[model samples]
Target: MLYNNITELIGNTPILRISPEVHKLKNIELYAKLEFYNPFGSVKDRIAYGMIKEDLKDIKENGKTIIESSSGNTAKALQILAHINGITFKTVTNRIKIPEVKNILRILGTDIEELPGLSECPDPTDPNDPIRFIENMVSQEPHKYYHTAQYSNMKNRDTHYKTTGREIYEDIGTVDYFLGTLGTTGSSRGIIEYLTEKNPHLVKVGIIADKGDTIPGIRNVDEMHEVGIYEKTLYDDIITVNSLEAINGMETLIRQSGVLGGPTSGGAFWGTLKYLEEVDKSLSEKKTAVFVVCDRVEPYISYIQKRRPDFFEVETHKDTIRNLSNEELANVNTISIGEALEWVEENNPLIIDLRGNMAFRTSHIPNSINITDNYFEELIDAGIPFSNNILVMLVCPVGEKSNKFVALMKKKGFDAYSLEGGIVSWRDAGYPMKPLNLKKKEQAVI
Candidate 1:
């Protein structure tokens, strides 16, 4: 039962039968392969190490560094494994929206080169973007770097074929319908090839983000054409899921089954449901559909907060609450950082963090509860009693959102104060802070 290292725990992820509540169908027997259980927390852990392991001796002997152009699951997997193996890792990343994932990359001491251009699938012709930068690095000095070109590398598709594909077939003898999102398309291509050979009747469904919608690690058809690893012919049908639907699926899974997976996983689930809605109920119930839960939810929590805030928003639309007038809401007073710190030292207040979960995860006041809205009142009313005179200090990245929220809470007869200058000021004032991890202390030791 003991392993020498985390890399040994790469594949053979557990598959759980999804609840009918999340699927909203009595017809399809749905199941999800939980890839978040992988050592670095993603399905990509399979290919990240699988693609690079054979080349390690050459890379180390030649004094070359491992490089990849990624910001999501792939980046996380590479950084963790590369560190464990004593390999120098560098990332070509753009503005990564997922704070928790980005924090992990930074914490690993991965050499990060930030691409100013914001496109995930930037034009290959643009020499400044991450993808093109990778091209130049390896093309110019091939020996100085070992690039695991995930998109075109058959190794990526092959690794999944050998591991992910074999595991699913062994676990569920017959998969009538298999669903996976399109990014590198390694997982889908591998599974589809292996399963169809086992059962020619298997229906392969490829999920894609709707046009102009941004779901992490998924691409539309037009955007996917450049990736050589994707197999268009294997898919019997391609389903499109928008950003909101994906988040809803993610939230539904968490609330119903207590399983936390990223939006790409949700996109696959949403696509499966969409597909079920179009098929005959009698036939679907007789079949089994398996979806890959691509990664964990921690990275996308802030994204979910921004896209569909209702999931985390407090129940303030009830009749038990009085409606606040705009005039009274607008004039609520704000408290300075120093004043807020002084109040914190003197009294125990309910600190509500208004920033997105990722931002709050980066740094916040200790013991503060992370919430999207003024739902702290809901908690208080629900019998986690608070004194009428006690303060509800609202913290944000900046003062704007918290100020408006402060105004609304004031009108509703709650003693609320917006921390002026927000968390940015808290750091500027040298106040003690808390992070989602003990990364600060760990970094000091390292």
Candidate 2:
């Protein structure tokens, strides 16, 4: 395993066969592509080096900074590679939800330019898209920066095809099914395209997070369309897994198979099992399936603790939104855009916007005060911030977060309602929105 340089250790990661006793699949042999074994500790290492290796000499000689839109592994790998080769690396992204990932990037000397966009996936409509920002920067001074646009770059997929796909085929020939969490869609696209040539019947299943849910390194179903590398036709089926399901799946993999993978890996595993269970019932022959273990879980400790505080023996409030029962969630009061408009005029309810301050300053419902969802949760932890007498309304990007909060509020005896379809619906309904214009000094204070 000796190598002259770390880049030499980028690919050829081992694939582990899951024990039948663990997965409990009667007719299928399930395997996990243990991609975390890569030198940079994730599947992205292959592409990180692939994207820059050919151009490394030119980039170094020209003194061009390596830049990309990445919040996690890709950024980490590129930064390390850039440093080792005497090239500056910059990460422009809005998807850094995990604090540890951001801190790790900073520790690696990554020049992080964080934008205020909320979605982990690209939003073509969003003015602050990281890819769009990078494109603008490169266009203005092309020689100064080398933009490795992972989402759109063919190199992202080509590298995976040449290495990852080839490695898998060599280890386990003619994979019947390939399941992978869709981030840049590079790995899935490259792997499936390669595998399909070997086995025409190979089922390619793409995993995504549920709508309005966050799973680090993967896009939600609603956001998938905005990704340039994503092709709906490429996947035989698409599956959605939630944050809780992802963690649960990760735990199962860790305890049962000793695969120390992250949430994205867990999501792929969860989706794979869910899809295969039904297929197994009708199968007569031996079939093989593979899912990717994208990265290790150490970086997501805070993310895990926030969702499952009881794991750490921390005291959790009974009325927390995450703890809401199915019945409570189903009963959350929600008002449609038309109904909300008339209701607002008559009831004069206290409107609370749960989006970030930057988004709030851009545009929000008139007279609604921005609290940001995290701070709003803290206020609830302390006790009722408002009297039960006043009618209240909760707002968010979509209806999801507001719906969950409203469920908890109802449990606490608050007369609250969530705006159906949230602020997006209100905007589409042509309701007037107010934008707060803050001076430079006031912006700094905020």
Candidate 3:
């Protein structure tokens, strides 16, 4: 088990059988290929080490700083790889909300440049956007930086082909289906290529995030791209899993099977369930499928909280025992994020962030107090700061749960109003959601 460096510990991640209740329906056997067991805690550890180890000459000569645009995991893996190799690394990314990923990149001394605002897909016209930003940097400073651009990098997919794909075949000889989330298309491309080579009939389900959804480590439908060795024609099925389903899948994995994986893994699992449910019933019977566990779950706690703390009551009000009508629900106190912004300007509003701790830390209205989930219980535990003069505003990813909570808070004699449209709308309206830790607002907004 001894190794010269952590890079040596990159591949050979363990795969475990997943027999959760939610996945029990169609006589299909699901297994999770746990890439988080890798040293840097994600599958990207494979590609990061693979690319850098291949380019020691380039790194030693001209790679003053290893640079790339990333959603998070690959940049993190590259940061670790760069640290060991005595090279600096920089990241060009959008507003990455995951606290764990951000902290690691920050602690590693990564020169991160964050793009302001959210755009579902990369706009070709915008020079300061995600995929384009990296291109601009590499084009501008080819001598000063070496870009490990995962999207278009052949080595990115090739590494997975050589190691990740080969490992699965060597471990479990007959994998009926290979399910993977589409990120840089490295993992899926590699696995699909190798697996299909062995069994031409192997079902390749490419998982993608649903439209208007932002699941980290994987691209949504709007952001889809075919870069590097990515062959779109190879996929037997392309499944679009949305954000709520992803959260449910992640929670199921953690609670039922003890598989703590990131949102991409959630999307992969969601894809598997969808494939079984909607795809041909003939393939559903006694099928063996392997899904990629892309990364560990620590990076997405905040997102998890926004969904609901262990309660998928987003179908909503089930636990209320007394259902509130649509008119009653509509009557709950509310304020626009703009109005809330104005209130905050003149006076202090006790902004009770109902999103998880990490999400609050990632971005929240200034001077807001975060309350944990199990809503009423956590509120009681923290003790109410309610008073007649005090303005209390509740926040969540969207306004649904906040509106529900406002109903409960009003009955509790607290003057609480849900911030209409939640934080997403606030950001959508071009209001600034401060990137908490990073000091440079202009240079690096993450």
Candidate 4:
């Protein structure tokens, strides 16, 4: 279809049904709103288009360039939207995002601002730090720049309320549960607010980052992205799933439904499945569950193919980590840093530092082994135990990488826990460390 403006392509994404085999147990109908069908190949297209249009409406008297912070998909969508409207686009993103996204941004002539350190924030509570960085750029360059502020932008939620929510309600009419990921909380909050107003019985379920407590129902302090203040108060219920569940779910979508979606979208789909199973057992009549297939998985093709070659080959393994209280991990399981330190001293649990080789070599917990030198296969081939009996604490400079690796190991049938603060926190806590010794001495130049 031809469109005169990007705003014209804001909504009306197609919805597809999940196969009967995929929904065998629940016996309830499952549908995914294929949001990738949007102009930018992601659901963020609606928000990017809507926010720009709204910003333009109020500021028609003045010209403004668009700016925002995004990991990948959102940035791409905004860039495409801004370009079509003849507005200059600038994006502040971390260097750790997928290379394909960076390539797209560069090709779109986006003035790229790269943030120092990890791409995703480690602390969700400190939302201002990232926004401040973006604000600094806007201050220095006053050339008609407006920040989209996805994390805290009410417009993001408004877009979904006006477009996506209406489309779903029109298509399904009676959706018992509205499920989606909690990246910015815009989609969930918008849909929940709109649908709940129409039908108070509609339940909104949100899937949050497993490392942190961004989700209302789950609690963790680890840093991860979440919807901003304006977007937080829209959900009825929330669920948290770790990287393993997300990855497995992504693989399942490809295998079962031929729907290749990103890890976050897969988590949403999995959460929806669990919700359906629960509601089915309780209710006498069949209920409908709908989720947004936020984006296509093509961008992650290289990373997943390289990291998880056997991901699709294996059958879905039952998750072994029981849902335990924080006290359990701290007291009974003894995985907390303080307790783990004691066990490290007494039992010498195999500590594999998952951080970069330089970070691992610079300083680490005493007696900790460095596994970053080789790939996972080499480490496993070199006699690393693959059983859950072994106590393994994956360590990094910070906790994010370690958390991701620990999740992968757990999926491979290993008992793994991430060091809370990674090596940085360990060093700050006055823990003992040894620096790598250099073999060659450098001479001073005049």
How many pairs of residues collide in each model?
1, 0, 1, 4
Write model 4 residue lDDT over 272-326, tens digit each, in one string: 7766676777776777778888887777654454345555574422322223334
- Per-residue lDDT tens digits for candidate 2, residues 278-304, read 999999999999999999999999989
Tens digits of lDDT, candidate 1, 269-312 = 88888887667365624678888998888877766765664578
Q: After superposition, which runs of candidate 3 have C-alpha atoms over 4 Å from their true positions?
A: 20-22, 119-127, 226-229, 278-280, 283-285, 310-446
Candidate 4 weakest lDDT stretch, 10 residues: 212-221
Query: Quick one: ranking by TM-score, best first?
Result: 2, 4, 3, 1
- Model 3 lDDT per residue over 1-446, tens place: 57886767889898888764657756667788999999888998888877778776678676578888875778888887787777888888864766677887887778788775443322222234566767776789778888877888888878888988888888877788888888789889988788888888898888888653568877776567535556789898788987778877887888888998877787788778888665436653576778888888887776666555545344432333024456667789998777767766776767776655445556666656556434443444355545745667877666766787677666656787887887777767777665455453321111
For this target, which candidate reaches the highest TM-score against the unseen true structure?
Answer: 2
Q: Rate the local accuracy (lDDT) of all candidates.
A: 0.75, 0.86, 0.72, 0.65
Per-model TM against the reference: 0.68, 0.94, 0.69, 0.71
Give the residue spans of candidate 2 off by over 4 A: 117-126, 382-384, 439-446
Query: What is the alpha-carbon RMSD of candidate 4 to the true structure?
Result: 7.2
**Per-residue lDDT of 194 in model 1:** 85
Which pairs of residues clash in candidate 1, taking residues 3 or more apart in a chain or in different chains? 27-285
